[model samples]
Target: MRHRLLALAAGTALLATTACGGQDSPSQEDGELTPLTAGVIPIVDVAPVHLGVEQGIFEAHGIDLTLESSSGGAAIVPGVVSGEFDLGFSNMVSLIIAREQGLPLTTLTNGVTSTGEQGADLGGVFVSGDSDIESAADLESARVAINTLSNIGDTTVRQSVRVAGGDPTGIEFVELPFPDMPAALETGQVDAVWAVEPFGTVIRQAGGREIASNFVDTDPDLSVAAYFTSEQRLAEDPELFASLTAALEESLAYAQDHPDAVREVMTSYTEIDQSVVDALILPRFPSEIDRDSVQTLADLMLEDGVIDAEADLDGLYR
Candidate 1:
């Protein structure tokens, strides 16, 4: 996944003028709503965006918003870069790697964040109840399933092992979708799984034991993901960007204040069980991105060989 993203950035130069620079919509006239599309992962992390659309927040801003689901950042990044999506939702690690490799991208608003609580975070590394792997340290040289390789999952999982006095270099990372992790762990397809809610909640209810809170171990206030757009999109319509940013901020704040609403919104977009939703450990959705936590992720990425150069953060945010 790391190398594939780098290759996308390497080839972006040729597509910049036609793809990134192409206008997806005409200029908005007075009292006209600009239509916008965003590629997002249909996970609990994005409940706020769904709730925002349901509450007519984007409509109030004179924008017609559509949320499209994809597997992960691999699809969302390219969709935004090629103007197929006006905006995208992705983790900090993927965005950092994209920026470092010369993809013209910038964050528009905070998406989701860690709970900053060790055993109570929204995501964690889990194992079967009777597995001999009792802690993060036992993960050395063990196969662990994650949604993406060389991204936030393995990076934070490695950090958890390191913090537990284990050598993280020997760990083996396997890529698997978040929804499939619980089944894989139950069947012993992997030693453990790094999962996020409400899948994490599912695993917990199925007698899976969380050995480590990967996000919390990486950074107490880790800015896990954000809603972003290509620099070209931002430059093309600053007014639309401003209105969408305001709408997103309101959505994030609303989700933070209304936990029950967030839970209710998840069922509309995701196939997660209602029971799991009730037991979910929700992540924080702040209106502002945590730059310090983002930098921490970038540093870890560099150390982990995920990127060859330091990411330029100066113009990475709107």
Candidate 2:
């Protein structure tokens, strides 16, 4: 589930030891662009940022970023919380759950959302061709694979299953990385796999078929992932914040304008073959946060017990 995923870490064991030191804005040392490290997952949702880095988008803004892959908030959150990573690419549900569990985070920019085209291949629950599952309702008492649990992966599935007239409470969620899902589905390790973007397209090519489209099934226009930082960093370095945001947005626009180029750049971040890359169905790159969609997600989380309280969405984003 990536854009639909979550990796939340709690307790002192996962806490970051260091937080970023305070700074006013982007720093320059003898005219060198400021360098910052970022935490990310190599999924389609994060392609814009990677494309920006690959094609000098960030460099053009007088900044350079080092992107490190992390599955979900479990690793990404601690890095940001401890000041180890300047920014993190992750899903909204993962961030919200982390915040609910005591992580202080801030939204940088909206990442990917549904393309608003029904069944256009954004994200879905898939099963191998010979599998008996034919609909979301068939998923009851089945083993489902998700990149991470208790975040977008499980949340969206529950919503879709309910919509399909099934009791999701009987569904068993298993954590399987996206790269392993196709094989898992093929080998019968999982009855259905929830996947997004290029991975979804990859699975379908490998004899996998859709059981339900989570993005569209849950909400036609859903806010999936975003680039974010800890609240500590935002307060510590407002200037760097502004600069990074401008550069990231510029790169996002480039991604939207040049889909083919965006896919080419994506191959560098993911292990999918160039052949697969050439035919992927790209998720829409949203320019700004959608408060209504976020609010709707929060309401669902609250209903599902993923969050104990309503998240202050306006305070978390611009």
> TM-scores for all candidates?
0.94, 0.91
Each model's lDDT: 0.87, 0.79
lDDT tens per residue, model 2, 1-318: 232212324333333433345433455655567778899887777888888898898887777688999876556866786678888877788778766665778888888887766567578899999988899998889999998777888889988899899989899999988888888888999889998867888887897888888777767778888888877677666787888999888878888888988888887878888767877788878679776787778888888878778776665684
Candidate 1: list runs displaced more than 4 Å: 8-30
Query: Deviation in angstroms for 91 in model 2?
Result: 0.5
How many steric overlaps does candidate 2 have?
Answer: 4
| Native-to-model Cα distance after best TM-score fit, residue 90 in candidate 2, in Å | 1.0
Candidate 2 weakest ten by summed lDDT:
1-10
- Prediction 2 TM-score vs. true: 0.91
Clashing pairs in 2: 1-5, 7-74, 18-82, 25-239
Candidate with the greatest lDDT versus the true structure:
1
